[model samples]
Structures are given as C-alpha cells and as structure tokens.
Target: MLRADNLTKKYGDFTALNGLDLSVNEGDIFCLLGANGAGKSTTINLFLNFIEPTDGQASINAMDVTLHDRETKQLLSYIPENLMLYPHLTGLENLDFFCGLGGKSHTQDQLESLLRESGLQADFIHRRVSSYSKGMRQKVGIALACAREASVLLLDEPTSGLDPKASNEFSELLLTMKKRGVATLMATHDLFRAKDTGTHIGIMKEGVLVEQFASEEVSFRDLEKLYLQHMHN
Candidate 1:
C-alpha cells in the first residue's frame, strides 16, 4: 500500500534521503529505526507529498504521490510526533472537523464509536482537547483513520513523549488497524516499541537504509546491540 522507489531528496550539497527503496503491504507495520538526521522523517514527508522528492518516487496504492497528490492523500493518514488539534474543540468536534476536510461524514454515534475503538476514553470524548494528553490526541488521529477508511498510516516519532502504558496503548491501536488491513510505516527511536509492535524493522544511517529484517528474527538485546553498532560506525 506504500512504496518508495530509489527515493532521493537533496538540498543543494546535502542529500537528506539517498535512494531509499521500500514497500509496506497491506497488514504490514514497518517500523523505521534510526538516529536523528537518518532520513526517517524525510521518507515519511516524501510519501505525504509534504515535500517533493529529488529523484525516484513515493507512491500509495500504485498512485504516484506527486503525480496524484490528492488521490494518494485520500488513501492515507499522517500522525506526526505532536498531533495538533484545536484547544477549545472537544475530541469529537476535532474528529468531525478533520473528517469533513477529507469529505467524510459520520453521525454523532458513529463518531463516538470510532473514538472508542481508537482507544479514547468514553468520558473524555466531549471534553476540550486542551486537557488531552499526547496519547489522547493520537487516539483522535486513529479515529480519523477509521472514519476515512484510510488504507495506509504514516507515523513519525508517534510515541516519543508518552509513558510506557500510553505508548503500548498506541501500539495496540496500530495492531487493530493492521488486522483491518491497514499498512503502517512508522519512524521511531524506541527499539522496544519497534520490536513489540512492528512486523518488520529497518535501520537507516546517513540517509541509507543499512539494515532490514523481520522483527521476530532478533531479541531485544540483539536489536539494541545492532542499532548501537550502526550508530557508532
């Protein structure tokens, strides 16, 4: 559902992403592990069409993102490190508003149901988003995906500031979407979350994808050792 083909992005003398070739199929949660400036967010932005690729392409469901920006965007949802919502709006209102932007409409009951399924607490649905923790805001993003029936999810550092429990909750929500055949490409620094939540893990360094493997192939300790080795090189 997501693909990057020799995707390269450069700014003058600097190459932010270097010939990245990747694919995330239906029901696959592909987590990207890398240090800062390793091109993780660059990959996500290329897919989102937030920035144009210098060479090659990023596509969703066979539609080239730059060539068919609107159509490809309709097939995916993006959750950045810090999700932004109107502080005065309730979670339900924010969900409804964003859904409307995507040309999706849901009744109140359906909207509430979606939020609940995304793991939002029932009592907080009507409360102002200003009071929500980072995890709660992310749940709304998931709800938006459900409402839109998005086939792909692009997440960048999505679990960064959350407590372990909240991060785990977010991972559970991703698993739920995975079961429904949504493809996910996440950029994260957390090795444990990547191992526990990802079906596949990739390590990138200096704009190159240096390692890729099935998550079950390595234990947590080995993954850490491998990641550190790459970082130190």
Candidate 2:
C-alpha cells in the first residue's frame, strides 16, 4: 500500500501542498488531475523524496518515507514526464546501465524480454535512443521500472507524447501490471486516460485536493465535467 498522511509543503509564505492525504492499495491505479500549479507534482515529489515536507508523512507499505529513504526508494520506480536516456546508447544498454546503477543486473535476453513486456517493439530494442521516438523512450522508461521490480510505480505524465495506438498500448501495459498487484500513482493532464485507467481520481486545486471520485462511480464524461467545475470554482 502507498499512503500520504496529511502531507504538506510550503515555500516561505506560499503553500504548495496543504494537508493532502491519500492512500493507494496494491493493484490500484490512483490518477491525479489538477490545473496548473495545483501541486500534483509536489505530491509525487514528496513520495520520491525530491523535496521534504514541512509537515506530515508519505510512506509505502507503512514504511515512513522520512525515516526509510533507502528502503522506500527500493520499493518505488518513478517515470518522470520527460524520461531522459543517453542518446548515444542503444535502448538495451540504457536499461542495462540504469538498472545496474540501482543494483540490478540482467542478461541480454532478459533485458530484451522486459522491454517488450513494457510495450517496446522488439525491433527497436537494439536501436540508439537518439533515433527512437518519444513513445519509444517512455517504453524504455517503463522497462527500467519493470527491471527495478518495485512494489509501486509512479508515473508523471506517462502518456504525454504517444500516438493513439502507442498510448493505448501503454495503458494496456499499466492494466497488466495492476493485475499483477503493482501500486500505481499517476499524475497526468489527460482526463480521458485517467478515467479509463484510474481506480480512483483526485482533483487538486491551488495546493489542495478539492475533490475526489471513484472511477467506477463516475463516467469519464462526468469526471471531466466535475474536474472543470472544481477547477473553475
């Protein structure tokens, strides 16, 4: 399970997050939506420990993030909006080296299979990242996350640059992972994808979670309307 207990962040007199609390269970995809500067990224950053909280706690499986940095990091795999890789290196080598940096090593065949599982084309596995498209790079990012073998997956704008077909493929990969009991917390601007992929949805406004809804209870169109209503108010 992943939980954020009244997590708060402040910048001098400005508050980026205030008493934001959430819980995501295994096999759950919790998609967060918000207008610009709503603190969706801040919430994810708190879990990644990129920034310390002014108050409250974020944890995985009940392991407090502040006290369990190494252990918490071990349980998480983060895919940022722009997943950076060495353009000079082939996809395989990039995954190999990055995962190795995290103390994970894999055989060539294993790496290829993992990439394919994450929706990368088998043919592109040997291509240099410079020649690959955005969707391809994101696939490699997801592949690395898979290689990390963590209990939780954090996706930030995960489908930002993919074509319709590619985006659908990525969504399918996420659904597949959910079936395997992986916890997912995705911060995205795409409400359509959020409704389809999210087991739960949250709307953040000006550093607060103003509203939340269950995916099963609200249709995608309804969620969009509700999202706009929250953003406008």
Candidate 3:
C-alpha cells in the first residue's frame, strides 16, 4: 500500500535520502531503524509530501504522492514523533474534529468505540487531552487513524517516550491494526519493539538503506549487533 521508488532527496550539498526503493504491502509492518540524520524521517516526509523529492517518487496504492497529493493523503495517516492535539479538547472531541477534517462524521458512541479499540481507557475518553500521558495521547492518535479508515500508517519514533508496559501495549495495538490489513511503515530507534511488531526490518546509514530482511529470520541480539556495526561504520 506504500512504496518508495528510487526515492532521493537533497538539500543543496546535503543529501537527506538517496535512491530508496521500498514497498509496504497490506498487513505488513516495515520497521526502519537508524540513528540521527539517517534519512528515515526524510523518506516519510517524501511520502507525506511535506517536502518535494529531489528525484524518484513516493506513492500510496499506485498513486503518485507528489502528483496525487490530495487523493494520496486520503489513503493514509501520519503520526509524528510528537503527536499534536488540541490541549483543551477532550479525547472524544479531538477524534470528532480530526475525523471531520477528513470529511467523516461519527456519532459520539462510534467515536468512543474507536478510542476504546485503540486501547484508551473508558474513563479517560472524556478527560482533557492536556491531562493525557504520551501513551494515552498516542492511543487517541490511533483512534483518529481508525476513524479515517486509513489503510496506510506512517509512524516516526512512535515509542520514544513510553515505559515498558505502555510500549508493549502500543505494540499490541499495532498488531491489531496489522490484522485488519493496515500497511504500516514505522521509523523507530527501539530495536526490541521493532522485533516484536515488525514483519520486515530495515537499517539505514548516512541517508541510504544499508540492509533489510525479514524480521522473523533474526533474533533481537543479532539485529542489535548488526545495527551497532552499521552505526559505527
């Protein structure tokens, strides 16, 4: 459902991403692991059309992202490193507002159901977003994705601040989305979570994809060792 074809991006003398060819099909969770300036976020920005690609293309469902910006956006959802929401609004209110932006309108009960399915506690749905923990805010973000019926999810540093329990819960929620055939491309620094939730894993270095493989084929220790080796080179 998501694809990057020879995707390259350069800011004058600095290349943020280079010749990245990737595909994330329905029900697949592709985890991108890399250090700072490794181009993970740049790839996502290309797909998001937040910035134009210098060369090549990013697409959703065979539709060119740059060319079909509006149509492509309707097919996917994005959750950045810091998920933003109106601090004064309740979780339910936030859902209602975001979904509305996508031209979707849901009843209160239906909206509440989405939040619950995303792992937010029932009582917390009515609480103001400013009072939410990072994990709780992420759940509401997931609910927004669900409300949009988005087939593709682009996540950057999704588990950066979560505790072990919250992180595990987040992983479980991602698996649930995968079961429903959501194609997920997650950029994360957490190798353990990548191993737990990803179907495929990719490592990037200096703006290029250096290695990729099926996640099930490698143990966590092995993956970590390889990641460290790439970082040092």
Candidate 4:
C-alpha cells in the first residue's frame, strides 16, 4: 500500500508536482496518465526518494519514504521507460545480476525459472540481450522484479516498444502479478493498455491530478473523451 498527502515538488520556477494526493491499495493497478511533462515520473521519484519532496510526504505502508528510505525502497521494484541490460550478457545472466544486486542470490536454474515465471520463454533463456527485442528485454526486467519479490511495482510506459504479441504477453504477466496482490502504480501513454490493465485511472496535468475514476465506473471511451478535454483545458 502507498499513500501521498499533498505531495509537491518544485524546481525553482518550475513546478513538477503540486499538492498531488493519492492512495494505492494492495493489488490495485493505478494508471497515472498525462502529457509529456505532467510530473508522472516526479511523483515516482518522490516516492522512490530519488528526489526529496519540497512539500508534503509520501509513505509506503505507513513508513515515510523520506524518513525510511531503505525500508520503503525495499518494498518497491521499478521498471523505467527505458530499461538497460548488459548487452553482452544472456537474458538469464541479466536476471541473475540484478537479483544478486538486491542481496538475493539464485542459482542459474533458479534465475532461469524466475524468467519463466515472468513469461520469458525458456528457449530464449540463454540468448544475448544484444540480439533480443525491446519486449524481450522488458520481460527480463519484470523477471528481475519478481526475483526480488517486490511488493509494489512502479512502471513507466512498460509496453511502449513491444510488438503486439509481446505486448499482450506482457499484459498477461502484469495480470498474474495483480492476481498475486502486488500493488502496481504505472505511468503510461497507451490508453488501451490502461483501460484493460488498470483498475483505476488518474489524469494529471501541470502537476495536478485533474480527474480520476474506477475503470468499472467509467468506460474506456468516456475516459478517452475526458482525457482529451482535460489536456486541452
């Protein structure tokens, strides 16, 4: 679970986030939508303690992110817009490296199994990342998160460059994580993916949360219309 109360951040004259308040419960897929510089990543950065908030506070399960940085970080796993892998290493090797970095060491087979769990195919397990596609790389990213047993997943445009099949597979993997009750906070530009994968959606603009809704309470079509109106406001 995560909560932010009146969260605000500013860079001199530029306000990245302003009085943004939100709560994400366990197993909730919260999609944060906005234009190019709507402070989506700023919110994440504040929560991740990558940047300290100029105002207000963010917490993970009642622990303040700023005050309890280590504990809060341990509760989260992040997938940024662009993930980097060791180009020369195999997919399984990448998985092992990140897992070990997290103070968890798994054997070769264990890491490969973790990859399989994240929907990475066994056949592609040993191939170099240099030869893998974008989607394949992201699958390994997800595999790293699972291997670390992260409780909260923060993703930014996770499905961006994937082909159709890979995108769908990635979506299915997210569904599995949801079933397992991992709280997910995702910032994505793909509306269709947000519609199907998100339990709730929030529209943000100029550092403010303009509107929000439960997926069940509003149709995707209506959300799109509202999104259009909000951005142009």
Instruction: Give me the runs in candidate 4 sitting further than 4 Å from their true place.
Output: none
lDDT of 2 at 130: 94
Query: Which structure is stronger by TM-score: 1 or 4?
Result: 1
lDDT tens digits by residue: candidate 3, 1-233? 99999999999999999999999999999999999899999988899999999999999999999999999999888888878899999999999999999998899999999999888999999999999999999889888988999999999988899899988988998998899899999999999999989999999998999999999999999999999999999
For all predicted structures, in order, the TM-scores are 0.98, 0.97, 0.98, 0.96
Best by lDDT: 1
lDDT of 3 at 192: 93
Q: Model 1, clash count? A: 0
Runs off by more than 4 Å, candidate 1: none
The sequence of per-residue lDDT tens digits that candidate 1 reaches over residues 1-233 is: 89999999999999999999999999999999999999999999999999999999999999999999999999999999999999999999999999999998899999999999888999999999999999999999989989999999999999999998889999999999999999999999999999999999999998999999999999999999999999999
- The CA lDDT of each predicted structure is 0.95, 0.90, 0.93, 0.88
Query: What digit string (tens of lDDT, one per residue) describes model 4 on residues 1-233?
Result: 98989999999999999999999988899999999899888988888899999999999988999999988888788888777899999998888877887788888978888888877778899998898888888889888878888889989888888788988998898888888889999988888888999998999999998888887788889888999999898
State how far residue 206 of model 1 sits from its true place (Å).
1.1
**Candidate 2 Cα outliers beyond 4 Å, as residue runs:** none
Q: Which has the higher lDDT value, candidate number 2 or candidate number 3?
A: 3
On residues 10-82, what C-alpha lDDT tens digit does candidate 2 reach at each position? 9999999999999999999999999879998999999998999999999998998888999999888898888
How well does candidate 1 match the true structure in TM-score terms? Answer: 0.98
